[model samples]
Target: MDKNELIQKYFEKSLSPEEAAMFENLLADKEFADEVAFQKKIKKVITHEERATLKDKLRTFENQKTSTDKWWYAAASVFVLLGTAIWFMGQKPDYDTLYASYYETYPNVIAPVVRNNNDTITDTEKAFAYYEKQDYNKALEIFQTIIRTSPQEEYAQFYSAISYMELAKFSEASKILSGTNWSKKYADDAIWYLALLELKTDNPDASRKFLLEASKTSRYQKESLELLKKLD
Candidate 1:
């Protein structure tokens, strides 16, 4: 069978044992092998496109605090300045009122940092310490606990995923990270690992999808974007 037919049959799991053997033999041909690789890439792009909407939602929620804080300052300053200018131009003094209004609507912006009350040192710190000591199993245990107890804890999940990847269990790492519903903090990082797993597993399509999703977040945005560019 041709490369197209072989690939289709492979995906469908409909290839007979003889056909499968023949397909494997065809992989020895450089042109046929390249075609298989190209199909994998296409699959990645398609998967990534499917998750685009979810990725956008995650980004929106994750950046809400930063975006809100930035705009709050800008709007408040503009309102206060405009009010002062108006007062100075012989209009009624409204600077105080405008400032009050702005203050009431927009409190101070404080970025939320993830804190783990369950541990002495932070989970990330502990995980790294264990990792540096070459106690990967211990590090993996701590990271896994953090993930199970506090899935939203970005650094812990990131470290855990890294540990799994380091152990060469890409599928396990990907399974732990795929469709994760945590805040934007570790989501992108997880996506990055998932992409790497897909690449390692020879699933270019899945890798492309993950890279695309990761590109939407600020954490891995630059790297993901660059990867996508290179792929193109």
Candidate 2:
């Protein structure tokens, strides 16, 4: 059998045992070996079904009168393979799974609702009530009011950011989380949540930075270090 015929049959996966032996012998020639290497490169970019079509077209091209046509086809195949490799390399990390694995809304720690107490409930308690019920919009409304009245209310600021995050208002959440002076109560907690917010927004680098800082804190150090390893 002709060398080109054997190579085509090999690629098409239709080679008999005898033809495979002939194909192996052809690989001893330097030019034939290089051609096989070129075919291997194209193989990496195509599916198994497409490989059959590729081999057929290569065989047909070689049968034509001009050697230049075969050279051009190989060149085009390399171009396409390189383009495919670049595209796969540029694909972003999977954010959805990462976010889902790590995300949980912050709990209502600042205010505990007493169902039948004689004392009047404050605005902070009302907001935390809404937060525990997962009514983030209403909770945020009351939190904003508290922050306006008392700028140093750390609990209001932290939960406001948490409410924004629950509403998928990443920009607002990031603004509050980034600007707030996290008290000892919420220092590592705030930093850890900020890392998660960045991960949700597909900002892995920013998430990694926050995780690194969180790793230095007491509360979230172990979790932050583990998440940092996953990012790397």
Candidate 3:
């Protein structure tokens, strides 16, 4: 059979065994292989061009101002959706990108207990100073020591988790956040950060749960809902 006919049969997966074997033999020729590849690419380009042209026609029909314009709009919307699906199919899984999109340093709300001299500076002050300087390792050290003495120091506990998160120690961060009471001032923040950390750690199910919990809080409802939509 001719190359075109054989190619058509190949695409339809309807070639007889003999024809299929012959096609493969023909494709062994470098020139024949190049032709087949060129034909396949052209088909793709033509299909995409046809979609674009049809979409333009649909848009023009929608602009004609008629009772049927709603149908035209709906038709055009299908092409838009198909385009989006195509784009999504071509996209790489990007956990890091998603994490960066939502991850930020949790804000400092700890009141400084000392200001006058270094000798009087509380561990909280030293830790927070390190935290502000983005020396999260040093901050984590101080925060851990302080939380030992002030077990109910919610801010210390919370920021220590933030330090762990900054160090990419997601399990440690999640543990600290999970152990703390949710009614504390950082509850909403903990839920949100934990959700994001879950995403970073490749735990989508847990991430979704945390996002759902965060969504319940009025402060994070809209944002968490948006993130949940992206996950789905």
- Candidate number of the best TM-score: 3
- Residue 134 of model 2 has an lDDT of 94
Question: In candidate 1, which residue pairs clash?
Answer: 43-205, 44-205, 48-209
Q: What is the C-alpha lDDT of each candidate?
A: 0.62, 0.78, 0.79
lDDT tens readout by residue for model 1, 56-134: 6455545664765756655565576568645665653332333222221111111124435555667666666677676
State in Å the error of residue 35, model 1: 24
Looking at model 2, the pairs that clash are none
- Model 1 alpha-carbon drift over 4 Å, by segment: 1-125, 147-154
Q: lDDT by residue for model 2 over 1-232, one digit each (tens)? A: 7565566578669999988888888889998998677546434534453466667766776787387677887768757866875675577657778788888888776786434476887898889889999999999999999989998888889999999989999999999888877778887888899999999998887786677678667778777766754554
Which candidate comes out best when scored by lDDT?
A: 3
Clash list (residue pairs), candidate 3: none
**Winner on lDDT (2 vs 3):** 3
TM value for model 3:
0.64
How does candidate 1 score on lDDT?
0.62
Model 3 CA deviation exceeding 4 Å by range: 1-77, 86-93, 112-119
**Sliding window of 10 residues with minimal summed lDDT for model 3:** 110-119
